[model samples]
Target chain A: MRTILSVLLGVIAVTTAPPALAALNVFACEPEWGALVTELGGDKVSVYVATTGRQDPHQIQARPSLIAQARKADLTVCTGAELEIGWMPMVERSAANARIQPGAPGAFEAASHVRLLEIPARLDRAEGDIHASGNPHIQTDPRNILTVAKPLSDKLAELDPANAAYYDNRHADFVHRWTQALQRWQAEAAPLKGVPVAVQHKSWVYFFDWTGLREIVALEPKPGIPPSSGYLAQVLEQVRREPVKMVIRAAYEDPRPSEFLSEQAKIPAVELPFTVGGTDGAGDLFSLYDDTLHRLLEALGHDSSKP
Target chain B: MNTTRFVIAACAAIGALSCPGTGFAASDQELKEIQQQIQALKSEYEEKIKSLEARLEAAEQAARAAEAKAAAAQTGVAAATPPPAPPPPAQPVAPAAAGAFNPAISAVLLGTFGQFSRNPDKARIPGFELGPDAGAGERGFSLNESEVDLAANIDQALYGSLVIALQPDNTVNVEEGYLQTTSLPWGFTVKAGRFFSGIGYLNEQHIHAWDFVDAPLPYRALLNTQYGDDGGQVRWLAPTDWFLEFGGEAFRGDAFPAANGPGHGKGAGSLFVHSGGDIGESSSWLAGLSYLQTRAGDRVTGADVFSGRDHIGIASLVYKWAPQGNPTQRNLILTGEFFHGLEEGTFDGNRFDQWRDGWYLQGVYQFMPRWRIGFRHDELDSDRLAGVFAGGTLDNLGHVPRRNTALLEFDTSEFARFRLQYTRDDADLTTDDEVLLTYNVTYGPHGAHRF
Candidate 1:
């Protein structure tokens, strides 16, 4: 009995003890921001990622632990072009943390720093799932990541003044390395320019812009809607007329649609690592681009090695 | 005009005289002709200048009118149509003010086809009295409870949500409507209006989120189809790495287990505490303890009417396991709850004391993506007594009541689900078997369910 009592007491002590305070606590709505925070803040910040690389950011289930983390967070970073419209508002309301509320300094949005794409000419719900603000998937291009990192680092420094110098230095180093990588990737991906591709969804506009790939058509009749038989037939007919090289989809998207198109069009179906940790080779932001370009190059029958 | 011509002719004659004898001087007739020519030229120049000025004035007037018309058209277009799309590079980051004011609205449609070996005559738990709301659903193809939800943030400090359920009989029921504080300090939140009490783990969840077709026996018998009442609640979250929370509620005691009491007072109340944390990368667990108390005034049970105090206690635990990266592909969850209660009251003019308890354990596993299977076991225990009831007993308590259930479910997408469930219940004198097929579809913006 005495031994059991001691064990119970020890367990209680361990659970009740407060965790060691880090310089800053960040709550990230997606894995990409979590990785970005780690890159910029290093050991000065501790991050909690709300959604994994494999989960769609548009919808997520709420958990009490997420609320607990948000309540104590000093900063909340997210893709704020309505990507998290389903759950983020409820989380903010439930957390009751003034620091992370809308219009507060602690709330940082990645989409705010970069120029968005696909702003609709008209606003209407009948057009299927469309973002009024524009496409929220800005992390597909590494250049957008650099654009976001500078402002995010500044926000982190403002939130944690003691680590201002640390954040500034990290931001500089990241920018220098990212610029060099962009130049190299552009040179290596020259063969991919003007390659015609069909996409499962309209989520890769930024990526195609950077690589100079042309989107021939899409599997979905409209954004965020599944394809119908009639739409699939139309796509197949277009494929016959056009020089379609491959079909591409994000790792999180269902692969069946793209696979169906590939079988009919006789093109390779390639799944790109849309974010960090989406695939084995795409462990970080740098490798995510590397793997994306390499797979597209390989699909086009070009050697993936440096020329 | 005559004076101008004379001056011209005189100048011409002076010019002829000054050139002395080298050329012939102008004659009178010649000078007169020169004067007439000068006069014609002067009139032509004046008419041309007048026409040019008039043309310039008309052009300026037309340009001014065109400018006004263009300015009016720009404003008219803005007023008549929606705002033009802003430039993509310079789009504002601020959230859409119009969309923010509109509450999130969603609807869920549920339909089921069921078959039973025996008729379900107000399904009872053998030893416990039931309320009017405790009836099992109808057999054959039936429209089950459909729900419409509306939720919105009222302001910076308050949020509100409402759920209205539509029964198969076309009766509308307000399942929940409450306003909660969002900006309370010290991890404190307060809620007011009608809501389900936080007395048990499963009580707060809606029917659409249930893993099984029907609720556990304890919920039907002890709480009379789950405890929902007009009330107020306060909750506090502890500042620690572990998930620790404490909450309490005070409600009007007009629901089951406390009927015919003062309806407008704080006659019913409960307290609960829960704690949870991740065990590792792929597993998590939560445990909770809850207590409820109510005053019963002429509460009816079977053929007897009782009046006294009742106390109930509940303990629950939930465990979840998933692979390291994704839960959609594979996961398993184990949930269990135990309920115990004591009632001390007068039954049909005779004083009696009774003790009852019930428990259920269930497990659900997603063996593959979009497919899941689940199993549940239920049992109830009650004290057996002879000659304690002046009227009559509902059933012999010598045998313990038990139930078993199995279910298979498939999800077409995040917004739709299909499930088939089979249950064998031995809660009464005879055993009963039931099979149920259900489909649920959701539309519009639905908020995520809490885990």
Candidate 2:
């Protein structure tokens, strides 16, 4: 009888304890932002990522879990150049969290910090799912990540002022490490300058600008349209004349188009980790860039171990 | 000798004084000409400086006017077109400030060519009466109903969505129009307006998203195609690891099954609970239970009126499997729902109680990225009433109804689909076979459907 009473008292103590309030809840729309939030917030925040590495960020199905997470978030981060236009608005409306509403201090967008590429000179639906704001795949280049980190950390501090010092220190440390990594990458990737390549989509324009890899042609007929047989033939003809070394594609994209081009043009198809967790080695922001360079260098028949 | 020397000195002194006076006159004239040239150069430079200052002032005024015009144009664009919020610190496209009210508009066109083994005039259930608009379309080349949808955020705390369906006979129906609260506290949302009831799984989905060309036998018999009425609803989502939801609705109950009366007060109400979660890396499942109850005052079916209480209960389960978490390439879905209803009422001056039940099971498999095949089976059972009822059609009372359907569909793109379906319906003594080929296309911005 005494033991039973003791067990009952123990259960009451466990159930009545208050939940940890020090941890801020964060909702990230993609895996890259999720990794960034974790890197900065550490144990001071709990994060929920809405999409996996394999899923396309352009469209997502409406789920109750997403709404539930959004409702509880203190800060919501996303690549907001219309990348999530298909469902983000609806999710925001459903979650009804005033803190994470547009224009709120808790709402952060990474694309706003970086200089967006591929701004269409004209707007037309015939362009095939073109974003009016610009290209939203900004996480491919590490330089853009460094640019976004400063503002995102400030946003976190604004939302949770108690953790301002923590965010500031972490952001400063990240910037320092990131600058050194950028220098190392530039030195190692000197050989890739002026190397002509073909891409499956326009997602790699920023990455190309960083590495000095020349994009000779694209496999996609338009922005999002798959190439027709006639279009593929034209690309093949262009590739034969220009003689590109490799065909590049994101790991999430279908490999069939790249493979078809590779077979016809007799070039290698190299799949790059477009964001964090895109490949096995790309577990964080640092490894994401490391793996991307390693694959690109390996495709060029150069030893990545030396770099 | 002294007198001659003095005369020579005086002549030499006069010659020296006259020569000095002539040189001074020549130097004074040259100095006056040089002073005139210097005055002309100073006046020219002063005139140039005055004109340059006027040009500079004009250019500055023009620049200020241009800036103001650009600001007005920015506001005009914001008011005219509902632009999405601009990213921070970028002045390229000024994000709509507070008044961005652009609503998403979409339209869906559904067309079908159906071939029936027999005349559609004989398509009737034994002991059931069809509604006014329940008949299938005319034999060949008939236009099906098309839908136009408009949705927008009403304000910071509310959202509005409307769908209007255009019928083949040049009539328009407001299928659904509702305003729902978005930012309710404690995971609660309230919706007010006309909407489909939160009944079984497939009831809330539009026909364009249906697996088959038409609703199953159970849905048609129990809910008259789909149960929608002017109503108010409240839904709550649980804060849990898995997906859990509870909802309740109060409707006017003016549509079929319920009598047309003053649609105020608690005419009809329903309660439902649903839960779903992933089973493993590649599989997921959802299950739900719902209950609805209403009082029918002078409800007319065929010729008789049912005045009493009606209750319905539904249970549904769905399981989906996709290999390696990629549903685009291949997936399989198995879903089923069972409905049971009880009606106690006075039929043609005679008191009668009846019980009815129906169920359907369907499975769809996508063999490839863009191709899929599906099969569905429906079965229904009803309790036969004894004694003759006045002004009613109850000829074959004890027959069980069933149907079998098979479909093959191809999705050309995300916005276009083509399907061919064959159904063997055995609702009457004489079975009917229907073969329908359908094409569905969507235009504009369409939101992603619920999973």
Which candidate should be chosen as best, given lDDT against the real structure?
Answer: 1
RMSD in angstroms, all models? 21.1, 22.3
| Cα TM-score of candidate 2 | 0.82
Interface RMSD of 2: 8.0
The chain B TM-scores of all candidates, as shown, are 0.77, 0.76
Question: In model 1 chain A, which range of ten residues has the least summed lDDT?
Answer: A55-64
Candidate 2 C-alpha error for residue B185, in Å? 0.9
lDDT of 1 by residue, A21-64 (tens): 67889999988899999999998999998877776566454556
Q: Which DockQ-derived CAPRI band holds candidate 2?
A: acceptable
Candidate 1's residue-wise lDDT over B258-279, tens digit each? 7766743337889998877676
CA lDDT, candidate 2, residue A272: 85
Q: Estimated TM-score per prediction?
A: 0.79, 0.82
Q: Whole-model Cα lDDT per candidate? A: 0.81, 0.78
